[model samples]
Target: MDGFDAHQRQMETLCGRLELIADLLPDQADPTLCKFTSDGIVKTLSDAQAFEEKELFPALQALSLLETDMKEIFAQLREEHYEDLCFAEEVRDNLRAIIEGHPSQSANATGYMLRGFFEKLRRHMAYERYLVSALRTKKAPGTPDAS
Candidate 1:
């Protein structure tokens, strides 16, 4: 497949993983189930980061100087990536507390915080998908819309 097609597939896969985490968020808030859910989220984020750093980031860098629109899209995506990192850090902190056998109240509080983070992350993924779609369309100039 072409570069755009490959990128689109990668984005879709990443979004699918994010959706799984989003779906598990409520269950994860149970404190008892938090460890499994947190593990899943950490895995998902790590996979996403690997894909972005290895594939997407390089593509964005190469394309950025070729088009103003592409550069702006890349910038927005990079900013969103930073936000994702913050979310991941929060997740790590919550998981660390849970692993340390924090008080029940603390576990519940962390679960609630994790739920909020999941919601924000879900929205961020949707926005990133939209931006990626737009960038793909713009990058292809008259190519038939495949997204």
Candidate 2:
């Protein structure tokens, strides 16, 4: 599959997992669930970041497939990636605290953080899908595929 399609699948999986984690946050009774979700988030974010930086961004740049305005969009997406990384790290820290017998936030606070992160992730994915559709619509000047 294309990079966009693969990324979309990965994102779909991540979002589904995140949704489950969000649902579990209210009870805060399962340390195993917290650990599993935290680990998944860390791994998924790392893989997604690497794929975007090493594969997707380079290909887009090499082909000049995106319009000039897309540069701003790319920048914003990169920023969002950074933000997601930070959020993931925070989640990891919370999990660590729970594991280490340290004081942690209330269940409500944890739930709030998770819900906000999930919402942001959904929004980010939607924007990326829009960008992919836009790129698919654009063709180089004078090309046979140009409309």
Candidate 3:
């Protein structure tokens, strides 16, 4: 599969994993699970941000199918990515605090944060599905031979 497709699959797996995390948080909060989530999400968000900004965004930008109207959507997506990364770090720190025995300030708050993050992430994936569909239906102005 292409890089975009691969990243989409990764995001799907992450949503599943995050659902599992959501089910366990504030109740089970196992140190291993906390550490697993804390470590995994940061890396996953970082990689996705890099790929979207570098490869995916540029590819779309270079295509004729994307219009000025869509520019704002793309710009919003970039900002969302930054926000998502920052939010992931906050969640990671919270989870790590639990792993360190400090505990979150509130169980309800932890649940709220997890739900908020996943909801935002799911919205992003939905937008990307539309964008990717548009990309797939069009031909990029290039050949296998660069020249």
Judging by lDDT against the true structure, name the best candidate.
3
- How many backbone clashes are present in model 1? 0
**Strongest candidate by TM-score:** 3
Q: After superposition, how far is residue 14 of candidate 3 from its true place, in Å?
A: 2.5
Report the number of clashing residue pairs per model.
Answer: 0, 0, 0
Q: Which stretches of candidate 2 lie over 4 Å from their true place?
A: 58-68, 99-103, 139-147
lDDT of 1: 0.55
Report the lDDT tens digits of candidate 1 across residue range 109-147. Answer: 654665566666657556655645655655544444434
lDDT of 2 by residue, 76-125 (tens): 77898898999988977876676565638876786677778878887877
List, residue by residue over 60-107, the lDDT tens digit for candidate 3: 666656657657767888888889989989988887887888866687
**TM-score of every candidate relative to the true structure:** 0.53, 0.74, 0.85
Question: Where does model 3 exceed 4 Å of error?
Answer: 143-147
Worst 10 residues of 2 by lDDT: 138-147
In candidate 1 the C-alpha lDDT for residue 114 amounts to 57
lDDT of 2 at 55: 61
RMSD of 1: 5.8
Candidate 3, residue 32: lDDT: 77
